[model samples]
Target: MLKKLGVLAATGMIMTALTGCGSSNNDLTTNKDTAKPGSEKAASGDTGLLNGAGSTFVNPLFSKMFSEYSKEHADVKVNYQSIGSGGGIKQLTAKTVDFAASDAPMKDDELKAAGGNVLHIPVTLGGVAIAYNLEGVKNLKLTPENIADIYNGKIKKWNDPKIAADNKGVALPATDIFPVHRSDGSGTTHIVTTYLNAAVPAKWTKEQTGKSVKWANVGTGAKGNEGVAGQVQNTPGSIGYVELAYVIQNNMTAASIKNKDGQFVAPTLETVTSAAKGALTTIPEDLKVKLSNQPGKDSYPIVGTTWVLVPENLTLDKAKAEKMLTMLKWAVTDGQKYAGELNYAPMPKELQDKGVEALKKVKVNGEAVLK
Candidate 1:
């Protein structure tokens, strides 16, 4: 039985702080492509900063990129608000943020109504680690079946023999089990449910569930990644899942997960990137390729891509709009170098090609950013 997280619980969240890797405080205040003798520099005649909202999952990484990007180009500033994916999309549709951050992509009609194209740039890759706290338990490994059992409330204690069976020689505990989950419409929840649905279809389903599931299991509910981290840290015998970034930042012990490739891999930059290896040249003209449970030996599976939501129209302030496009271009290309150090995967070369192609659709004065 998979845990349905839609319900609430009373507890705390445990988070681990892993120093972000390859992060740079490099900023580009002004967009200037020094032209060759006769080459033209790309500019929209607008020079200012841009502000964006949505996607708490990528907030840490984006913040690093923005801060680094700000150093050189004080003229332009990029600010991202971690308001969660659902809110991000709503903000994007409402024209609130210059760009939206979402783990998930927009739907077809949603794209149409906006009268522009949506590009899915998977700038980073990571997995949701099931963090837990227990007595005398330093390292706990878990398979998909065990995760399913715990969330389903089928296994109720830290010392379940079934789990002991899998980890074989590790000492088990007797603490009461507490499960933590998100309470908002999160892309993180969507990635986990997508994994459960794939690994154990009979118990899971074919639904496009969000970060917080209709968790049938009983536990506490937190607001965002930070909220869940707070909940788990305060509670004993508590287990909750969040992106690898949070797990590292909070200093929590994460469980080993079985991936679609049939190998049980721990959440790491290496594993996460391996799982994202085979994405299509163009993410389905519709963005429905579930990256969880992908099949491969090195593939850790259970991965998710963070997407940038840009509006097709230049209906907003011109200076702000150009700055938004500037950040997107840099983040997807140069800034990606920092992904691994942050425990995230960089976009694959081919996939980046697809991304660059999709970004071609982003326009200002009928000119493509890639151009």
Candidate 2:
């Protein structure tokens, strides 16, 4: 089942060590681009150095996409910092980075703070796996109620009746249940909490859903997806929600979560893509849409679309703005190919078209950049 679900083994896979709060400088080779010279070079005739920060959830995909993009446009260098979504938005508002990536969409206040020009461009979709470390347990199924209670600190034992009821034939241990969560402001937290709120609305309130919540005062707190995954990997009886890529990268066990359709679906490329169906139809003009707890029976319950945050009227200089828009145009189009290998679902054709249209609105001193 795991192999059929496309979960890669950890044996020969090499995990790239990304810095927690700084830019990655991994050396990559360059390739030639076929785009017109005007779009390729900055107006000032200087190299374009674009800096971005945010969302560890999309770090794996961004790493590959940026590296591949640099390969084609050697004159443009993108330095992305994986310091969670909140930090990315903060940097974007502060005008410190050329752009930012986030799993969660910016709030109304955030938009106003950035002069209300920020555009949320949907780039990729992915699932948040309920990763756990338990001896002799390979396939674990969890219902929404079970998950709510476990995270709320109400279900502290592995052999609790609620958990045991779901797995009748399995050997249940009496170990203490440790729920891990992100210590920093995280878009992964926002998705999980939002799903929890949707799944068990009575238990998980709307007030408790956001990039950072007061996490029920239980479990341990880790910094990023890497931190939560590492915590679950090292601590027995520990469970945490992380991106599907992290789960597969660490070769950790992920639970099959019960979706709104009453089906327990595992996080896989197909399942995550299934959740993304019809998302474009509901997305507003802003392009900020949620994919969690979608209605498909085959859909993974904890799926979300990650976006790149760029201002419609860029704050950067004309030369840098042109380069940034060009890079973004390529990302929503060509950059999507690298998503699946990194455990992310590429944006649907309709959404990609919408993204291209939105990118057309990006301007440098009232002049469009794409043309």
Candidate 3:
């Protein structure tokens, strides 16, 4: 259950303050790679800077994309802040950032607040991995009922009968189970909650679902995906959720999830790719679609697609708008090659073609930004 942000009626000054809270200035720079003696620089000189912020889930991927993008396009620099999805939407609604990235699509009300002229371009697909820190528990499999109950403080011990039923052969420790959760507003939370709600409708009531939800007063809370991962790593018998990439990079153990086909599936590039296949068939004109609980036997249960939020009617100065659109176009096209290395599923060819069409629609004043 994603929070449907209401009309943003904040004044210009308030918007500026909100923007400053995340990044000191809009025009920030990252590492630069010097050009070789014979390499060609970008066509334009002093192309204005591009600024964006949002979605820690996609931050790791963006970091690589932006850094590499800078190496080739020295004339323009892109700066993106890895704030939570909520912060990104706030900045976008306030019209402060040049663009925003979100793992969850913006709601209808959010679109209305932006003058109904925004575009959600699909960027990548990933799974919401359920990672744990159980010593000697090499493999773990979780059911929707168990996951929902754990977060709600119902299942308190690692050796609980229900858990033991799932892991028949593994040794069960009688240790207390700690459930770590994201304290900040996050798209990761939304995806997890959405999946829980879908998989266990009777238990995960609508009221208990959101990007920010009132936990069951159980385990401690951490600030970001990194914080949750760190907490689970340090605290034995702790379980937490994060993007699939974090689970890999942190060397944490992830549980196999029971998919719609009644098969236990682990989160991997192949399984996440299976989930994205479902999204490909049903994506709408708005490009907002859910990828969780897909029907395939191999589809990971908690997967989601991340998106880039750009204004349909561009208002930036010609140079900045041109540069921004060019970079965005490259992000969906050439930049996709970088996704797999980071455990993100690149948009399939059909979706990539549609993404290209969407980016092509971005216009300044009245003319198309790209040919």
Clashes of each: 42, 2, 0
Arrange candidates by TM-score, descending: 2, 3, 1
lDDT of 3 by residue, 244-337 (tens): 7666665678899999999989998889999888767977988877898988998999998788999889776767788888898888889998
Q: What is the lDDT of residue 60 in candidate 3?
A: 60
Residue 271 error for model 1, in Å?
1.2
Which pairs clash (backbone N, Cα, C closer than 3 Å) in model 2?
A: 31-71, 55-84
- The order by descending lDDT is 2, 3, 1
- TM-score of structure candidate 1: 0.81
TM-score of each: 0.81, 0.90, 0.86
Whose TM-score is greatest here? 2
Maximum-lDDT candidate: 2
204-308 in candidate 1: lDDT tens per residue?
776535554667657877766766776777788888877777667656677777666666677777767667766443467544455788777777667887888
* Regions of candidate 2 where Cα sits further than 4 Å from its true position: 1-14, 17-47
